[model samples]
Target chain A: MNASVTARRLPIISLQDVRFSYEGGIEALKGVSLSVARGENVAVVGGNGSGKTTLAKHLNGLLKPSSGRVLVGGEDSSKTSVAMLARTVGYVFQNPDYQLFCTSVEEEVRFGPKNMGFGRDDESALAERALKLMDISHLREQSPVSLSLGDRRKIAIASVLATSPIVLILDEPTTGLDSVESAQLMATLDVLRSEGMTVVLITHDMRLVAQHMDRVVVMSEGSVALDAGVEEAFSDPDRLRRCKLLAPPITVLAQRLQAQGVLPKGAATPLQLVELVARVRGERQ
Target chain B: MMRAFELTKTKVRYPGSDFPALDDVSVGADEGEIVLLLGSNNAGKSTFCRLLNGLVPNSIPAQVGGKAEVLGRDVRRTSVARLATLVGMVFQEPDNQLFCMSVEEEVAFGPENLAIPRAEIIARVEWALEAVGLSGYNARSPSNLSGGEKQRLVIAAALSMRPRLLVLDEPAYALDPAGRLDLYALLRLLRERYGMTIIIAERDAEEMAELCDRVILLRNGRVVADGPPSEVLSDIDEVVAAGVSPPQIAHLSSLLADRFPGKTRPFLTTDDAEKEIADLVRTAGSGAP
Candidate 1:
């Protein structure tokens, strides 16, 4: 491969020994190093105060690292303004109320594009496209304040998506959503990922990590405890324990069956467990 | 048994809205019962909770019809200030309800407003903090606590009111798994020690099923199913179609039931599902074929 092409193919987001601390000398992140490929879907999971949110803020220049370096789109984050990074990295806060301020849903979605200096027509087009993507087109004229938590969350995400960032970061996106809405949101994220957007989600829902994310990053005590593919991450009991994280229930059941020699290893999902049990039964018959 | 609260044919239509937020809904909980309200967004779970404390018609401009009674008083007739002494509500966002400076002040604010004796208010604040496992956090600032701690503080503040019924709307939505487990244990402790009646509106059916005595499923502002978790959550199709996910164990059991008819029962927890799967494996190992 050409050197320039390989350079272009470098990870879309990279952190080299990043460290962050609050004003009270409390370190939120400690010497963390990670990289996200161009279009990977990664989940960051941990207990409360485990630095997942802090680590996410570094990707979009919302928080400058105390030491070390963070590179977004191969540019040094410390040298770039959050407004400048907004064109390539869009962040959704855990509480949609924190991000939603526009009177109407359509206006909320257009705020980001308009802030990014897009022309009036371009901003409207982007906002309309984002509204349709989030399935909230009908709610365009409705005030976001009068909407439910789920709808407000959708509006928050659509607002960020209107900016057309290459890397999208969401903190606890499924916190207030029901299962169906959560699944729908994940499907929409998958669609965005397929369109070459890198998705970084900070979540406590282990089932979502297993079902949607391609890779998992487990944080513990302000550090990265384990980073691997979803299956590899969930299958390791010690790593999960170190981070105070629980494997998905289906994974737990599969692990027990694997222990009793009733099924093979590495079944982390419900569908996988069913398939494995069927295969074992077939062999017995 | 005494009824903690009851609603009959309740309907609430907000001002200028075409559809009613709550439509002909009826549900009730006995004293000391732990009831869970499960529904998707805009399914009227919060509306139903608001009606319990007279917030629907008293505060918000809504046309509420039918009957809503809390602590032996009609909600439509009782004032919100008076209902505060009978029913305590903890909303989803902890920050929204917390305005006091210190944790002690937050817990004491409610009782102090109720004009309880100064000594009694102090005692209640300490008791509430201790009940929620925040005994030493009296002087800590609410902004300095973690999300889970803030929620616990809110619960403690509600507990200080010593209301007959406690309603929590998605209290554990922002908590982590461990935090959720802690909350479940705390709720159980409250039920066991204080004999408090808890009504939780949550989407995590799996954990709530294990904790709550009754599960009420709502759809489009109406009750679709109301029963024990074993019966209501077992109907995976209905629950999922209503935009609520059943427990993973229940989903697994349903799948197993499809594979082997009449041999499996829906489980609400991992332990029961584990035992069921173990027995199935053993039976398969035998010479049944």
Candidate 2:
């Protein structure tokens, strides 16, 4: 068979005009429509009350939409059980303490696949691969509860990764990590993306989005405020500010320089800005 | 004036652990000063914060050595309740710290337990809520408030005690950029107006450079670098080697300086970097870069 048909991309997760309200009748998500293609890296960013978490909850069947529909892998989310969706989409909550219950790191990582009916050997293999991917192989024997927040976060992600889901959703994964730890985690995600894993990252850190993500979905006041490529999404700071978000610091610096006519345009990452300055210095010489 | 707190040769070890959580760490902050803690995870940032609030050896059972003093009280000898009056803590996860149903009750809980007069407790509750920019949220439930609002409420709960020193652990890690700006502004107000000494452990250098006066870097439970933000954070190589990334503006300035030697001076914050870059362009005869 020719590879053309097999290589065709389709939406892995789709939210069609989904609307959701919390228990107190607070409408958290107001008519959100979006789609995620397989092997894509997307970031959902917004203020606290903008319904980013509410929208994510619908993807894994944690909350059913009040109106419209949520489709995961072309399957109706409301009809499928959360357990069934877990096989396709692995969601790691913002807090590592929420889902971490096992004693040892290895046990925590292997528990997911074991419950999913994988053989003991297959479970060990999956756990080992995930631990290695997250660079936490050395901490396998340690108690997960006693590990540092950064290490525990890695264990949480590895545990989810061990299930071998087609799509991974991480909420504020770098909340308690340093720059190096955050960079290392994002690099691991890059490696997974290169291997055809679809990732949906929800965070407030714009630098990560500017450097790593290709697409950004900005939420505001329980609505989809802006959805575009990274450069376009960050190009307009006023629009992002209205959404209660700000461009990354390096981006803002470049914008300030751009306004002064020193540079033609602003850049999203540090390396790009350095190169632009280098080009300008070369031209002046 | 006397120092707000002083920690000397402090060491902390947890049960069943091969290594100490904090190994012979000695650090302190002055009154009305904002000190920022920079380090990777398990670098004893939280442990240090706990030491100030008497949670290290008092609330949590851990092997301790050396001396810790908060507001002239010995941390190892004093009770956590007494130290609570001198030190306030705001943790990364606000939900774990907040328990009251209404916003006002949460802030009043600490003062009420201390047997403060009814008139004083009411005034404190009002002031604490207003201090955190949650004045109108007094009647609302903590569960119903947004993430930023909950964080403010937690801070209010700490402030209600009228502590002299405040310790916050990654307070803005979960907040949006706007919320973070608001938090930093409030922190500045506390230091300037209220004269409260603040010690915070945060990972975001971009935001901390402007708000903090002193910067301390911890690695493997040891203080590697400690100085002012201008000096400590500007050295990108040193900061990164200590297991923390420097601010983007600092890193950017370093890169430009590398390409054009002696042309760019080190700047850490966004406000400073803008001026530095514009000056470099102006000096280079800017036409089109």
Candidate 3:
């Protein structure tokens, strides 16, 4: 495909034949190999029990791959402790309750920086930066439990971002988020990407893959199925449906019309719908 | 046959709070009908749900003033155990209600609490799980289920009781998009197949507009707007001022209205919006103003 090799310039994470299993011998990930560069926004998509979350845990050294190797900035994931890896890889959980341990929003954001041995000034600065980035700076003194689910999610993201990790991995980033919250979150990730941070988002939302991610990695039955550009992967609806995923409505409409000889077949993404209409009109003319 | 009279005043105030959590709220839902409650965070939607099942004065000691009747019994005087047969209340987080190890046990807890027979409890459990599309997960542990499955399991638990009114308080908030769709499907089935009266307190105006026949909008603990979904959600500026997102299609429609002046007014759902758009295109093609 003549793909550029720019992603290999400064590889931050490298997984070689990575495989993982829970305590009960349920294999979650198998023979997975991928590399995440310093400033890449790679999205991992799959259905239930497809090992996306297991892969997320491996990035932060929380769960060691059972049979293979995972490298985080050249540090062996199996050998490094979670506390040590926390500085290099930040993991935001899907459920805010799991990550939110502090009472107040400010306390939650400050926990990571303080634990990482930052001084008072640096800790407060990181907390402020994280809170502002998540857009929950107004709720700094409010109790985390009392906040709405959306606001609590922001606090959870802020807590993770305070660690200032080189790589950010969020599992199911848009789960249960409304349109506004989802857009705000994607925008925040976009800002972080501009700031040169590596973002690895695990999601089932195809719209997110098409709109936000640079690269797409489709997982299935504990293995990587497709690792390609966002546009390339989502162009095939049959493949996506096989994984129990559906594209956005606009994209699906465009694809159906194209397949029925009503529009050009190249118009697969939603952004190309308008062009598809124009091309069809031109053909008629 | 369920009804309420002069239900004009029911209030619940937390200790040391000047204003009540629920203030002077009066709403009704007839049998075999779905009523949606729409509001922002801390808008007393949950409080109203708790009131339906007599959890206000009986369990939490709310200052219940006005009369609220459920299945012809005064809610203020009825015990929660007795009222359990009429109203089933599901909270936002399913994990809060699920304490049992297995799904079978979790769904059976309510019926058992009501002293139903063992055989009847088993039957009810099976029927409930089947209703929510969790038939095979009876032996599975509640903790082992996924987020979607767990929420369905919660719905199954509520359905096992066979309450006439199923009151869900933002049941889809913790679920993913697929999970939300599945929940809505189950709710539709409950309304159609079983003829259950569904009362859902939600912030998603689009879903409520599609699913419920009537939506009762609450603001600052008062019933501000109560009518059909089309009437309630069409007023976008008012809904926004009440601190809630209007329907997605409605929002887009309003934006379009600003651009295509005198073309189309906003609708709540995508189907209606599509029809409106098609009509607009036709009218514009016909040389309308």
lDDT of 3 by residue, B46-161 (tens): 88888888887789776877767777788888889888887888888877879998999999999999898999999999999999888888889999887778888888888888
Candidate that would win on DockQ: 2
Prediction RMSDs, each to the true structure = 3.7, 3.9, 4.6
Indicate the docking level reached by candidate 2: medium
> Which residue pairs overlap in candidate 1's backbone?
none
Using Cα atoms, each model's DockQ against the true complex is: 0.52, 0.55, 0.18
Model 1 stretches with alpha carbons more than 4 Å out: A1-9, A95-164, A236-244, B281-289
Chain A TM-scores of all predicted models = 0.92, 0.92, 0.89
Ranking the candidates on lDDT from highest down gives 1, 2, 3
Model 3: how many Å of interface RMSD? 5.9
lDDT of 3 by residue, A110-184 (tens): 999999999999999999999998899999999999987788888998998998899999988767665567667
Q: Which of candidates 1 and 3 is the stronger one according to lDDT?
A: 1
lDDT of 2 by residue, B129-211 (tens): 88888897888999878788889999999999999999999998668898888889989988888888999997567867889
Q: Model 2 residue A277 lDDT?
A: 78
TM-score of chain A of 2: 0.92
Fill in the DockQ of model 3. Answer: 0.18
Q: Which stretches of candidate 2 lie over 4 Å from their true place?
A: A1-9, A83-87, A97-132, A136-148, A162-164, A264-266, B15-17, B278-289
- Winner of 1 and 3 under TM-score: 1
lDDT of 3 at A180: 61
